[model samples]
Target: MPRLIWPLLAALLLGACASKPEESPERTEAAQYREAQSAMDANNYLTAIDRLKELEARFPYGRYAEQAQLDLIYAHFRSQEYPETVVAAQRFMRSYPAHPSLDYALYMRGLANFYMERSFFDSFMTTDKSARDLTSATDAFEDFERLVTRFPDSDYAPDARTRMVFIRNEMARHELHVARYYARRGAYIAAINRAQYVVQHYQRTPLVPEALAVMTAGYERLDQPELAAKSRRVLQENYPDSEYLDDDGQVDLAWWPREGKGLMSLLTFDLL
Candidate 1:
C-alpha cells in the first residue's frame, strides 16, 4: 500500500509539473536588439527588419532606438527594399541630424539610390547602365557628395568619393548618349547642347572626347564650320590618340556611340 501511494504521489507531482505553463522569456529593448542582431547575422534580413521596426515602435525613446533605426536602414537595403532603405535613412537623418551615425545614414542613403537605379535584372546583366534614366544615379551622386562634404573624416568618406567618381562618369556618359542620339537623328542644335553639358559638368571623364566629337558633328551638320573646327582642334589637342580622331587628326564624322540591346531590352522594349 505504501509503495502504491508513493507511485501515485510521484505521478501527481509529474502531472502538476506538466500542467504548469512555462514562463516566457521577458521581452526587453536589449533582448529585442539581440534578436534583431541574430537575424542579421543569419542574413535573415526580412526578419531583422521586422524585429527592428517593432523595437523602434515599442521603444521610441529607448536607448537602442538610434542604432535600431540605422540597422533597419541596412536591413531594408540587404532585403532589396531600396526605396524603404532610402525612406528610413532619410527619416533617421531628419530625426537625428546631430547623431554620430549621420554619416552612416548619408552613406546608406546614397547606396540605396545607387542600387535603385538598377533593377534586379540589371544587377545580374552586364548591360550598359549609362543609357538608362539616371535620376536615381543623380540623386545618389548628390547624397554621396553630401556625405563627403559634411564628414570628410568619416570612415565612409573615401568610399563616397570613389562612388562619386563613378556616378559622375555615368552621368557624363548619359549626356553623351543623349547627344549621340540627337546627332544620329539630325537634331544638331540639341545634340550640341547635350554634348556641351557633358563637357561643362563632367570634366576629367573619358566621355569628354566623345562629347567633343558629338559637338563637332553637330556643328558641322548645323553649317557652323568655325564652331566645328574649334571643337575638332580641342579634341585633337587634348586627346591626340582619341578613337574619334582619325590618323589625320580630324574628327571622324561617321562615329556613333555603340548601343547595346541586351536581355533587358528584350523584356522592356528598350524603355530601360
Candidate 2:
C-alpha cells in the first residue's frame, strides 16, 4: 500500500508541473526583447528584426514598445535597408518627439539619408543627371543641422556635425562638377553662376577653393579680366596656399579638389 501511494504522488507531481500557468504578455514581451537584444549583439539583424517586430505588435502600448521600435530601426540599419531604417526613424520621431531617445532618432534619420545620398554618384555618372538623389541628402543635412542646434549636448551631436561637413562637401563637389561641364562648353556665364552657388551655399565645404578657382578661370575665359582678377584675389585672400593654381599664375580651369581633402588654407576662408 505504501509503494502504491508513492507512485500516485509522483504522478500527481508530474501533472501539476505540466499544468503550470502560461506567462503573461508582458513577461513574454520582456523575454522577446532580451532574446532580440542578444541576436542583435550577435549581428543576427534579420532575426533581431523579426523578434522586435513581434514584441512591438504584441505590446503596442506597453513599456517595451518604444525600445522595440528603436531596435527595429537599428536592425534595418544593420541590414543596410536604409529606406526602411529612415521610415522607422521618422515614425519614432513623430510618435515620440519628447522621448529621451529623440536625439538618437534624429541622428538615425540623418544617417539613413547620408547613406542614401551615396548612390547619387552612380546616378550622376549616368545621362539622367536629374535623377540624382540630392533631395534626400539635403533633407538629411537640414535634419542633422536641426538636431545639432536643438540638442547641442546630445551624445549624437558630434557625429551629426561630422556628417554635416560630409554633406556640404558632397554638395559642393556636385556643383563644381556641373560648373566644369558648363565651362568646358563655353558656357562661362552659366558656369560662373553655378560656381558662385557653391561659394554661397557651401562656403565651409572643402570644395570651396576649387569652386573659387573655377569662378576665376571662367571669368578670365569670358574676357572679363576685372572679374577674373577679383575672383583670384578672393581666392588668394581666402586660401593663400591653395593647390588649385596653374603654372601661368592662374587658377586651374578644370581642377577640383578630392572630396574630403581640402586645401591647407581652407580654415582661413572664414566661411564657418
Candidate 3:
C-alpha cells in the first residue's frame, strides 16, 4: 500500500512539473529556434533557412534574433546558396560585431566567397585562372587573412590558414602561367617580370621552381647568359631534384606550361 501511494505521488508531481503556462511570445520564439536547429541538424537546410528567417523577422530585437541571423548564414551555406550566405554572414557581423561567435561569422563569410569561386567548371578548365577572373577567390583570400590575423587562436583559424595556403599556391600558379604564356610568345621581359613576381611573392609554393625555370629561360632568350646562369644555379640549389629539372639538374624545358591545356588542367588538377 505504501509503495503504491509513493508511486502515485511521484506521478502527480511529474505531471505538475510537465504542465506549462500559456504559450508566451518568448516561448514561441524559443520553440521556433529549436525547430530550426533541429532541421539544420537533419540536413534540411532549406527548411532551416525558412524557419530562421521567420524567427529573425518576428522577433527583430528578440533574444534569439541575432542567433537566428547567424544560423541563417550557416543554413544558406550548407544549401550552397553562397551569395545568400554572404549576405546573412555580413548581417551577422554587423549585428553583433563583438559576439563570441564572430570568428565563425567571418569564417563563413570567407567560405562563402571561397565556394562561390570553386565551381565545377574549375575541374575542366586549363590551369590558367588568369582570364576567367578570380575576384571571388581574391576576396576570400582577404577574408581568410583577416580571420587569421584577428582570431589567430580561434578554432576556425587552423582551417582558415589551410585555405590561405591553397589560395596562395593557386595565385602563384596564376602568375607562373602568365609568365609561361609570355615566354612561349617571345615576350621575354614580360615573362621575366611575371616569373619574378612568383619567386618573390610566392616563394613557398610549388610554382617557385617553375618561376625560376622561366626566369632562366627568359634570360637565355634575352641573351643574358650571366643572369640565366644565376637563375639556373638558384633553381639547382633550392630544388636539386625538382620535377622541373632534368637528370643533369638543368631546367627541363619540356616541363614548360602546355600551350592549350589550361582548361583541361584546371578540371583535371585534383582528379589526376
Each candidate structure's TM-score, on Cα atoms with residue i matched to residue i, is 0.85, 0.75, 0.78
TM-score of 3: 0.78
Instruction: Count clashing residue pairs per candidate.
Output: 0, 0, 7
lDDT of 2 by residue, 95-210 (tens): 99899999898888888877775554564564433335588889889989999999999999998999888777777877877887776556779889999999898888888888
* Candidate 1 lDDT tens digits, 114-230: 989786687668878878999998899999999989999999999999999999999898888787777655567898999999989887988999899988877777789999999
Task: Give the alpha carbon lDDT tens digit for every residue of 90-125 in model 3.
Answer: 888887899999999999999999879666776577
After superposing candidate 1 on the true structure, give the runs of residues whose Cα lies further than 4 Å from its correct spot: 1-25, 256-272
Q: Which candidate has the top score in lDDT?
A: 1
By lDDT, the better pick of 1 and 3 is: 1
What TM-score would you give candidate 1 relative to the actual structure? 0.85
User: Which of the predicted structures, 2 or 3, would earn the higher TM-score when compared with the native?
Assistant: 3
Worst 10 residues of 3 by lDDT: 255-264
lDDT of 1 at 208: 95
lDDT ranking, best first: 1, 3, 2
After best superposition, candidate 1 residue 140: deviation in angstroms? 0.6
lDDT against the true structure, per candidate, is: 0.88, 0.82, 0.85
Candidate 1 global lDDT: 0.88
Give the clashing residue pairs of candidate 1, or none: none
Worst 10 residues of 2 by lDDT: 253-262
